[model samples]
Target: MLFIQHLIRLLAQKRNLTLLTLGVLAIILFFGLRPKTWPNINHAEWSPDTQGLMFHAPGFAYVDDLHTLHDRASDQSFSICLAVSSAKQLPGFRPILMFHNGSDESQLTIAQWETSIIVMNGNDYSYRLKLPRISSGDILLDGKPRYLGITTGDVGTQLFDNGTLIAEKKGLRLDIPTNEKKLRLILGNSPYGNHSWEGTLHYLAIYDKQLAPEEMAASCQLNDGIDRKNPLLLFTFLEGKGTEVQDQSGNDQPLLLPSRPMALKQTFLAPPWPNFTLSKTLLADIIINFLGFIPLGAALYARLRLSEAFSRWYPARATMIISFWISLSIEMAQGWLPNRSSTLLDLVLNTLGAILGVLVIKMSWNTMENMLSHANSATDLAK
Candidate 1:
């Protein structure tokens, strides 16, 4: 057809062919080198025969009534320390520790709300602490073990992560009763068992006295001598194959693990994509897409202009077609990337950008041709 003859004529020119080759290479490099936009899943699903204390939502472990830590509950000062890691990167209130008095009247809870840590003394009081310089991907998908310590004293309450002070509040005190009704300590779950934590708890301890800064730091090191100051209750989870977590602190208050079987292997669940909205992130993406396709559009316009076999309208149409195909290819490639999403919005924007670029080049060429014609006419009049 005439279109094929035009295309062949365009490629016959050395400059046009070189420009086309460069444009194709640029598109490939841009998409191929971009970073991933989603978290990688370590395991697709849990194995059938897996064994460990697994907690889905509403599943948790608590010390039985006979082994309640009510006697160890301190009214004035206390400290709680633990080593924990999450199994999935989910968005919800996940309680790591909760001490309940068999009623909703009062409780002590430490939980993760999104990326931040929250500690509540009771229903009336709560403190939220944001992690420093953390991204959503790091907060949600990171499955590495983290050391956490919470200490409340006459001065204030302090929260620590990996021996670093993350948050602090002054003039707040816990008023938990020592001999409260049905008082029990729950691990990896909420007092109501509604916001259960989906994670692994390696070690936990509760002390009647507020730990000193040095003691708190040493405790986070995951050392055998972490309890040198003597804790009122402790669960090391060293009894790897048992239903009960032995109390290494000698008070003999072992916690019963949840009955459900859980796999001990590392597991990760990818979070859902962000909702589509007109925000700064979307604006940046639009600008990037528009700028990225400009060169492709320009190259196509130049190549089409080199061939006289094509009509005046062919350049714009050919440019649009080439832009659309390239944009689609980039979007399709993003589908396999862990952190990327292949959206139709990007494709549309890219095509529009290419069209704009082609129009701009066409206008400039016409203006240059008119100026040259006027110059020749003026030269003839001067002669």
Candidate 2:
């Protein structure tokens, strides 16, 4: 009982209350901004080697990887860029990047058909464009390194080879519809056919917005500029010896290589908000926000009690105002984090929790006073 009385007296001091309040706030921020790991959809068993993702068209080998970035890139004007060194040029189709939107009925592919580059939108083969003269000449076909880039917008699609415009066709805009089904991104092969890329791929990048002509040229040169700043997904084959391709953009979408003739090699590489979703559980989120602010409310109440000139009703109003500002700050800061989300629901629940804490302290004031009075009486007896 004596220890309880002493602890209460210590918390009644303004400095002690302020320190405790700050400590609690620090703890809340640490957990709220920590890195999040998303659940993987599948795993591919493969041995580590050093060949850097080799695919065989005859054997129909490919890599199927799942990522969380489909919603961000889907239904947006985007750009795709990669560097490839072909071992043997095949007259048939060779897929470089293919994405399956859950059903075999829909897909987005960036491929090479004979000496031409192809961009297929949706499942319909009629919606695709075959850009002739894009991959011609000895630099691309004679087993040498060359950069390839493709940009798509509502206006049209543009294909670039080594910083130069090769061929472009209008009236074909690519977009993936928003649906409930999961999306899978494939590398080096298509899901339907045995059209696998037989080559060495150094890097691949996906952007949420169409790259300007100058930006596309800079990206093709492998130089650092705006191209490195705005990628939704980027993979640099610098892991050297693993089946996992590290996402250089830091979005946590690691690519899993299937049990094929795939490997990673060392390569010099260049580099590179919160949006709200209604999919989260309302009850669980409210409970968490409410619990997070309870300590702040208790601290505010204790501070208000130390003021001698305030009215009896001042503590409740002051606690509410202070809690509002604090919650607002947290939500605003969350906007800068890539994985964290800011919502009005969280703000309201936090304020409510603080108000509840103040009310609880107000109702128990007399009980605390009684305990302190008993402790004083015991101290007097000891004297």
Per-model CA lDDT versus the true structure: 0.62, 0.63
Top model by lDDT, which number? 2
* Regions more than 4 Å wrong, model 1: 1-54, 66-74, 124-141, 175-177, 258-383
Error at 295, model 1, angstroms: 59
Candidate 2 TM-score, true structure as reference: 0.48
Quote each prediction's TM-score. 0.49, 0.48
Model 2: which ten-residue window has the lowest total lDDT? Answer: 264-273
Evaluated against the true structure, the overall lDDT of model 1 is 0.62
Tens digit of lDDT per residue, candidate 2, span 29-90?
77665433233111222224432455444212232434445456455788888876666666
Q: What shift in Å separates residue 228 of candidate 1 from its native position after superposition? A: 2.9
Q: Per-candidate RMSD vs. true structure? A: 13.9, 17.6
